[model samples]
Target: MASTITTDLKNLSISEPVVIIGSGLAGLASANQLVNKYKIPIVILEKESSLGGNSIKASSGINGAHTTTQSNLNVNDTPELFFNDTTKSAKGKGVETLMDKLAKDSHLAVEWLQSEFDLKLDLLAQLGGHSVPRTHRSSGKLPPGFEIVSALSKNLKNLAESNPELVKINLDSKVTDIKVEDKKVTGVEFINTQNDKVETLNTSNVIFCSGGFGFSKEMLQEYAPDLVNLPTTNGKQTTGDGQKILSKLGADLIDMDQIQVHPTGFVDPQDPESHWKFLAAEALRGLGGILLSPSTGKRFVNELDTRDVVTEAIQIQCSKANNKALLVLGEGIYEDLKNNLDFYMFKKLIKKITLKQVVEDYKLPITSDELAEHLNQYSTAAKDTFNRPLVVKNLGDEITSETNVFIGEVTPVVHFTMGGAKINTKSQVINKDGQILAQGLYAAGEVSGGVHGANRLGGSSLLECVVFGRTAADSIANVN
Candidate 1:
């Protein structure tokens, strides 16, 4: 790997550093590997004013198999089981090899972060479509995404401080074009948003981690037209800039039409019509929260079902109603999720109240007697008639008029794009013919796809960023 760096884009005489587009987890991971492990000079460009793209907003945790966190909890899990669960969740649309790679490296990815940065991921939970507990997060008030990104960002800043010429990170620099020569990427053309200046710099490699297009109205309309009108939980910086630039270079995109609509975006009563939504983490349901139809106050779908299934059920129910559903968490669940509950309460997205109080406060149609009967029925039943296990064994039975529960209005929102530029196991961008399109171009994270097919599991997004981001760095480092 090249170890020379040019501080200014105007200096054409100096050798170019390895260029990483986007400062999200994937891009930061790549840079970390390249500079720390390979001792390579690198430059990271981010379109946003701050670093950590949509990754910083991730509420759930990262998935791992047979991790130290899981082992400590006495949970038995393997990569094969994780693979089966992922493939099943993907619904036969995911690429088999990519899924295999992701599952196989799941443990190592978790360990890498723990060993390298000493980030705590001691808590484990079972998300939907998973048979066992595997998603790992720290037992802290701060979410996992913030912990991981902040740690990585601090590490990178330390590297930059020590070796100013070797590591450079420029915020508000957006890559507009890939400069290719002889069918190989050589550099990039970008605009410095601060000064409105256009510049070009030569580089040995370009790793695109610019992220998905969920927030892009034009891209959504073009690819998944049905999802254009839906609200998104993605950051504004996720406008498919990397995909658009790569596609122009003839990179074949796969599954662009497959978008994942997460079932639980908090519909703020203060601004119910806004398209930008704060995602209610899937862990909320995983931790024994139940979804109820606001009109009738009854469970409409299995809360632990796959996200797509739950989202479809919510959409259908909302179509008949006024696009409203209720997420009810028992006292035990609220106690377990005090951090998130307090935040939601501060945002006025959720309220702490008794069952009877909620009914009266929200003007629910169910009578107090009927609501008590319904809760008793759920509590006494071992499992639903459909054979789906209840979310929590004694959740419903524990609810009482004096018991305080957290309740929030939720609706389906556009969450993840399961499709983007096609890539091989090495994270090299490829074409439709199964051929590498550019020798010096690579991609990872949500910017490059085919890993998750029809739907993505709750915690796999962060795992994908770490696993493939490191893979891209390794591939680029090994390049002659």
Candidate 2:
């Protein structure tokens, strides 16, 4: 039962549909659950002309624990272990119940995409902050985010076509306000960007998934003042619209200052000063790349350390090297990440060269002998490395004058805002006093926080979207 709402604002004001804000994975996943499981009519409002939000830019895969894919690959992991790793990564600020739910449902989240949506997530890798390889993606050139978003968007469009009355997607519409009456959400007011006209839509339920405010300079200055000038990888629409709207409705925000800085945003040689930078996926290092101080030609941090830890190391190293560091990948890593490398090389963000060439072309401070010594030490340490304490192993063949490698200049960039409106385990948006703000208003994905306390793991962002997005929809679906 899918239907489109008429363009007439008056018609939308009279119809009470389940309205979901944002077209990211969270919004789409919630809509999928509502339409497929509950036969509910939905109206999704997106600020951008295209459907996919920042979700389309996610380069790394999604995290899952003890999935059939993991079992087949002989990865020994459990929800408990995943929970522990998450808590540790969060540095004790994590909400235990929310973290528990996230870890517990991760396996089902991945399986749901594969079984229900026909998305392939058979390949797995161990990203930073993981004890084992639980992040799943397809063995293809397309990034996991693009693949999942494309699949879900196409499916939703096809369903809308078949049942036009059940699903309506209004692109270029930005929700500006959430209306409340008798302490419950009754509707939302949004602006149609195309005509700069405001309209109100009556809805029994609203799912807020508008994403984080990483790109909002004002929000950054207010909440995370220290990161005001840092580069970011988020889309322009990631201005915390959902967070702002909910805050005005008295929803409590949690950990607003907890921002994540990714260690390896590529520093384009042609535009080194650009504020928008391309993220060098953590999968590159997970597959055996190493970060080196361009000045000293030495490894300063374990390649697989958490984003914050590596970012700190890179900052310190860059501070000493004129804000420059190099990420070097051997032939094995280059081959595994050939698609990513191809894009980077095409953009001139990285270079393919022999070890001697890297030394000579970049004018590395250390001699070839010193660089070889470091490579030998890393290769020796990575042998038989599999779980826990997350060591960098399998660094490929030892570096020699003739060895080939891919190298890119990298720097830390403001990546993710780990804070947003607070939500309960049921995915209901809550107030400052630990009470649900409105019966019909819910939040999930990056728009709602507290699942990740201080720092988020590399791949958990996507998992949060799928798990809580569905939870919010299911909670609304069962609410009579």
User: 1-480 in candidate 1: lDDT tens per residue?
Assistant: 213232354353334578999988998899999888887778899999988999998888999999988889999999999999999998888688999999999999999999999988998878888899899988878888888999999988887888767788888998888989887877788888877777777776899999999999999999888889888899888899999998999998888888999999999999999999999998898887878787677777887888999998888876655667888877677656778888999999999887788788878788755665676566656687434566544355554555567889988999999999989999999987789998888999998878999999999999999999999989977874
Taking every candidate in turn, the Cα RMSD to the unseen true structure, in Å, is: 3.4, 3.6
**Poorest lDDT segment (10 consecutive residues) of candidate 1:** 1-10
TM-score of each: 0.95, 0.94
Total clashing pairs for each candidate: 0, 10
Model 1 residue runs over 4 Å out of place are 1-16, 386-390, 393-397
Q: On a 0 to 1 TM-score scale, where does candidate 2 land against the true structure?
A: 0.94
Note the Cα lDDT for every prediction shown: 0.85, 0.85
lDDT of 1: 0.85
Residue pairs with colliding backbones in model 1 are: none
Q: What tens digits encode model 2's per-residue C-alpha lDDT throughout 203-237?
A: 66899999999999999999989889889898899
